[model samples]
Target: MVRTMNKCDETTVLNAIATCRFASASDAELLDAWTRDQLAEAFATLVNRYSVMVLSVCRRKCRCVSDAEDAYQTTFLLLAKNSAKIRHADRLAGWLHRVAQRSAVATLNRTAHMSEPDESLGEMVVIDNPLDEIAARHEAIILDEELAAMPERYRAVLVMQVYQGDPIETMAERFQTTVGTIRGRLQRGKKMLADRLRRRGVVPLIAISASMTTQVSSVEAASAASQLLGMLESSSIPPSPPLSESLLNPLLVNGRNLMSPWNLGCGAAIAGAIGVLLMGPAEGLVGASGGDTVDVVMAQKADADSEAAAVQFPAVKPADLSSVKTKQGSVAKVEKVDDPEVSELAIRLKGELDRVSDVSIDGTVESLADELQQQLGLPVLLDKRALAFAKLSPEQMLNFDSSQEPLRTSLRKLLDPLGMKATIENEGIVITANPSQLVHLGIGTDRWLSVDDETMRLFTEKLSESLKLQFIESPLRQVVSQLHESLGVNLMIDHRALDDIGVDDDFPVNYSLGGEVAAYDAIQMTLRSYDLELTVRNNVLLVTTMEGAEESLLSRIYWLEGLALDGNFDSLTQLIQTTIKPDQWEALGGRGTIGIGPGERPSIIVNQTYDIHRQIESLIDTLRSNSFHPQSKDTGAHKSTPARFGNPASGFGGGFGGGFGGAGGFMN
Candidate 1:
């Protein structure tokens, strides 16, 4: 067989495959074997023969040479894999071309990190009205030059689609991605091609026919230009064959029946062994799937996927396409706000944080707060609403920057009606409130935010990290001081105290918040006691001494669900004492509201899971107790608790509780 052959159109190649008689009866079978075995060499041949065409397509798809190269390599890889199944020699080129085209498109999809394949590539192309008479040959040359000028990635996609002839769906599946992703890529590729053409003087205007293409000068046209044009006319170049058949596997694998009897036997044996192992006594040692672990892992994976799957949107609206050529770039937009108060608050609050950008924090916080209210089944408090005290007003600002005594006095006056108290400290603040206060405020920590030894460890670590980012290593103290003045509070660190804790005040802290080792140690000392162990590394504290720690941690997280649901405080306090063994808590649950009681309202703790039935039961018990009952409720005089727990607006029973939704002072 000849190693090199004359250049021919894809159609001519297909005809040769259909007509030529091979010398051996097993030529088809041998070719099929060669498809997988010598795919590299076979692919190299295809590339050598069609490199120019491929380059042209890629040029049209990308904005630069590097991008085109990526697309080209990707397309060739696809061809190498798919070439084995092609049965007929005549149809191979056509098939291969199509696959190559799709591969280019897939490359764009992957690079752009899209979720869907674009279907708009076959749409009409528009050009300016004036360039029609430049001569067909000249137009082809111009188009070629323009395509080559584009980035490599763009050029590759164009080559794959327009020149290689691959379909959209094939490209999507080959890339192991979604159709939306492919479509997004194709859309980007088209816009780049259009832009390149325009820059090269081929303006794509409304007047130009979308179907315009390069044409060879006709004999009659040649004659018109020069009275002897007929003598100078030449035959037009024939169109190449379609690239579709040249690259498909002749033996298509049926997806539905992927496993043959032999494969099924192997799979069944493997499954059985896995099942047996899972059923063994060692299964108990395998442990329960930690819910918190799963949740955190899932959350992390979701974030990564979101980042990687961002698609570059086309300028064309999802609803309309004719107005713009393409999207310039992908970016977030800021919201328009007309209210001065809300705008001022947003600006002030956003400036006081880190890690999050200024433009986003304001929008996100308000949005999240609104969502939280809805999730908790409560109406949000607003300045214009009846819950005036809940809103931040002039009276609410009572010397927030002053010493603890004045601050505490002002907070007491503000929260007295709600039965709450505030404990002010230089470095910490704790809020104490009754169960009724929690019910009214619809805000409190629960299982999710519960202060377990581990949680305290995590929180302290996070705080330490935050402090480090803001103070220890940061030169932003001056800026921080200014912010404290604006917010009316002092945020300072004692260099000596930090040194005593084994952390250098000179350590630079990142602006992002997350407690460090010292923070965790402080937390252990101040909140969790010695129930948990803490170690610091790279400025991060790892607290991991609790026995059955994973299970305990999960429970703690589940308990937070109660907090998110707006559960009461004392009941939660009781639940913790009952659920966690004394040995586990280091005797922390023995005093005050720290222990559980049937009549108390639930405390919000992190990592606790309770069903609706338990939640209702808990609420009922609290309403029957004096903790949430109004002072007028004279036990026996109250007659009896209501059959069903009613809304806060309606009292639980005669004179038990008349109103709902009260303020809860901030936890120090």
Candidate 2:
């Protein structure tokens, strides 16, 4: 017996609903009128009733007003599209709340930029206190754990009351139970949640009331609702009729007059227009004279379709250099670049250094350098002053077999006391008088350099492949020295500090690692006996006492903008762990974690060195660059999932340390 509004305008209809007491109509009644009678007023009434609630959810989840508004529109649009699927009208509010949350999450995932649209729109400033941030994270984790541990039936009722703001009557009807039963379930759910939270040392009790409330005005809601309804009505395409209607007249197509040729042509034209709109503007839609040409337009459209069909999708494939071979009748000679050959030689030298070999040499530093130069076919420069300063006997016998240990380890054992270190240079391997001098020659920042996960993995693999080790009670210095030589990594040992701790070069280290264990792991095993640890400082490895290393473990926070929006948290975390040193992460333990903030920006929390933090930031930058193009090819095989790292051609050389030469050193 309700009267419909005569006027189609939003203000008039809203005024009519208010005056006629239609504003207070139940959602079930409004939905019935809209679905059964196709009454525009009924649809408008539903929108007005729930728009404020939807807006509140959006505002709470979104970073800015603009994003919230987009989410708001999307939520209601989805509700309208799926109206027929609503089986329980009384639970409509709860359903809408879920939809609003999903809409906001989807919106956040789609947009990378998360800045406040306008400060005047009441954007909340996030506090940047470390203690507060940690507390909030712990509270959220504890709450989730407690809720998940609760019984299903009790949990459901509690969620309905607290999160969805459903009345007790609505809950009873939804569960098909008595009011007393619903109240009992709510009470039990609350008590169980409180007990769990208390045991976990979180809050003593859970809040039963809804945390979020609608701050939007009735007038604003009415205006937004009216606009949404107008969009739906003016779509120029009607909603599909019920299955019953279609079944009754299977041959009769709705929205067109099949008997009239003109009506049929108009329908076809409308369909074509919709296709064009969905696909974006077509080429040659309008002629140069600002008029339409049917034949030319159709030809262009046909061409576009053909081109789209002909385009081939990129596939993961391996590089095929064999295809460069000439046909039987042709003769072609491939020319190699001298620079590339030199670079290849350097790579080979590193491989050679990794191989386990016996070294039984009784010679001076100069003689050792000369022998290495001749064997490796590369220049080996020894500092004369460094040798003189060491005051070693001219026939000092340094006899040891690498026995699968890294060449660097053997070299370090030979040269450590001489106040000299060997590093790869553009010219050749230079046995320099000062280790600090070599740092100056490296590329990028001396303090910190970026190394990707893939590069780190490849570096470790290469090191493992080159090394062949079997050690049973080897000197600690010799073990570390061999590891350093094969890896070409700078290992700075604090001898003075080690002496104070009653540990020295002859400290016995025992390991049974055979085959190709990772050089990093081998080094760690050797250091474990002395209670020593390794930390990276400006790309140099510092093998020092654990106490000294602990001083560098400082907590830092970094804002990883756009990472959460990309929706690749798992991939990103994996990439980080793979790229960074395993020992460094282990040292951080539970302190190292990444989380998506309320505003959708990802934040990294870790206790690490400043250099390590810089490296992480670099890796994050690389991830952001590859965010848009997620998939990558490898060895002709199509990746089942997007690559954790981008194209190898993008460059992933260099170790966790800085570049050694112009060549992308182990982690560059």
Instruction: Report the Cα lDDT for residue 580, model 1.
Output: 33
Residue 24 in candidate 2, Cα distance off native in Å: 6.6
The 10 consecutive residues of candidate 1 with the worst lDDT sum are 292-301
- For model 2, residues 1-668, the per-residue Cα lDDT tens digits are 98665434745466356435665466677677767777767776667666766765666556667777777777676556556666655446655655565555556675366775544234222436655533553454344334433434555566567554679887776665446446655654565566556666666342222123123455655566666666667765333321222221221223111122222234455444323223322221112223221110000012211210101112212341111222222222212223322343333344334334444455555587777666445567665554443344546655444444445556655554453455543345656442212212221111211333334334435445545666677876787787667777566776654654555667566676656665656666656544566764444566765544544454444443322223333444544544464323442221244432221112345566534555675665554443321111111111111233332111111111111111111101
Candidate 1 residue spans exceeding 4 A from truth = 1-36, 39-139, 164-166, 174-176, 205-212, 215-668
In candidate 2, stretches whose alpha carbon ends up further than 4 angstroms from where it belongs are 1-9, 12-29, 111-117, 120-177, 188-223, 236-668
**What is the Å distance of residue 368 in model 2 from its true position?**
80
Give lDDT tens digits, candidate 1, residues 1-668: 75764333333343234323321222233334436465222323344444545444443444444454445554444444444444443233333334434434445554443334222221112335535433332444445544433333334445445544557665444433334434544554565556555655665331122213421123212212221111112213211212232332221332011122223344545444333322222110111321211000000012211211101112222343212111222222222224322232222211111111111111231242243234222222222222232322323322112122322233334444543433211112222333334334443323333334444344433444422223333532343343334333323433332332233323332233355344323333421221223322222223322221222232322112112212223333434333333112322211112322121122222332111212333443443332322211211111122322222212211111111111111211
Report the CA-based lDDT of candidate 2 relative to the real structure: 0.46
How far residue 538's Cα lies from its native spot in candidate 1, in Å, is: 31
